[model samples]
Target: SYKPNIAFYEAHGLKGWQALEKTIAYLNEKCPDHFTIADAKRGDIGNTSSRYAKAFFEELNFDSITVAPYMGKDSIEPFLEYENKHTILLALTSNVGAFDYQTKMIGDQMLYQKVIDISKEWKNSRNLMYVIGATKAEYLADVRKIIPDSFLLVPGVGAQGGSLEKVCEFGMNDQVGLLVNSSRGILYASNGRDFAEAAAKKARELHVQMKKILINY
Candidate 1:
C-alpha cells in the first residue's frame, strides 16, 4: 500500500504536486493491486466536501483519503458516496496535541470513542476507516471494542517510537485490521547515493517483522 500525505507535495508548490502526480501514476502502473491513500485530512461543508471527494477519489484516483470528522456527518457523507473508495476518519492521532480533545472523557467514553460511535451511524459507513495512532498502541484494545471489523490506518511507528509488535498484538482483528506506517524511518534510511537501497532494506525489515507476526497469528 502507498499513502502519500498531500502536504509534503504541496510544500513545494506546482513542482511538488507534479511529483505527487507522477508518484501516484507510477504506483498505479507498477502496483495496481495495492491500495493508495491520500492522507490529506480534508473535511468541509456538504458542497465543499463533495468537491474534495471528487478531487481525491475521481480526479486523483486514490482508493481512500483521510478526513477530519469534526464537522459531523454531513461533511463526511460526501466521501462515503463514492463506490469502492474509502474515507479514513481521524480518531486518536499520534501527535501530542491530540490529548487536548481526543482523549477527553464524555460520559462513559473518551471523545474519540464518541466520534467513532457517531461516525458509524453515518451513511455508507461500511466504506469508513479510522486513523488511530500507533503511539497509543495500548488504546487499540478499547478501540477494537467499538469497531472490531474496521481497518485502522496507524501512523507513528519507527520514527515516532511506536511499537509495531504492540500494535499488532492489540490491533489485529480476524482480517489483520491494521496499516502501520513508518514514513521517516523508511524514507530517510540513508542520505547517501544508496538511498533507495537503504529504504528498501528498511521496508524489508518491517516486512519480515510483519510476516513473523502474521505467521504467529
Candidate 2:
C-alpha cells in the first residue's frame, strides 16, 4: 500500500508504468522483505497478454499483479505460466462504477460470481487469485464457496468504506487467504520525507488489526 502498486503508476501514463518498474526494482533492493505488485489490470488476446506477462514477470520482476478477466481463460493462462508469481483477476472491484456490470443479476447469480466460476478452469488456477473488493463485503461468502482454497487479493479497506471484520468473517480460510490492501490510506498518511515512515506506521496498525483478527480464529 505504501508503494503505489503498478496500476497507480500505469494510470499516469507509459512512462509512469516504466517508472513503476524501476520503483519495484528499487524497493526489492532497498527493502528485500517488502511485497511488490504490478497492479496492471491486463487481460487481452493470448499473444498480447503473453507479452504483458513477459514484461511484468521477466522484465520488471514484480512479485504479483492485478489482471482483468473480461477476455476469458485464454487471456489469463499466459500470466499463470510464470512460476510462483501471482495473477489477481478482477472480480468485485472497489469503484462505485463496478455496479454498472458486476452486480447485474444473471440467472440468480451476479456477473462477478460467473467470472470466479470460469476462472477456476484455467491451468495452475491455484496460483491464480481474485480481486474481491471489500466494498462488496456481503458477497465474500459466495465467492469463497466457489473457490475455497484460492487466495483473494482484496482492496477497499480504509478509504473505500469496506469493513475488515466483515470481509474476514465471510472469506477467511485456514491459511488466511486474504490480502486486504489499503493504498491511499497508507501512502498519503503524510506528504513529507516522513511519508515512508508514516506509511510503515499505518501498515503496522493494519498488521496489528489483522493479527488480532487471526488470533480470534
Q: RMSD for each model, in Å, please?
A: 0.8, 2.1
Write one digit per residue (lDDT tens) for candidate 2, span 161-204: 89999999999989998888888888788999999999889989
Mark the regions of model 1 whose C-alpha exceeds 4 Å error after superposition: none
Tens-place lDDT digits, model 1, residues 149-201: 99999999988899999999899999999988999999999999999999999
Error of 2 at 72 (Å): 0.7
Best candidate, TM-score-wise? 1
C-alpha TM-scores of all predictions: 0.98, 0.90
| Root mean square deviation (Cα) for candidate 2 | 2.1
Residue 84 displacement in candidate 1 (angstroms): 0.4
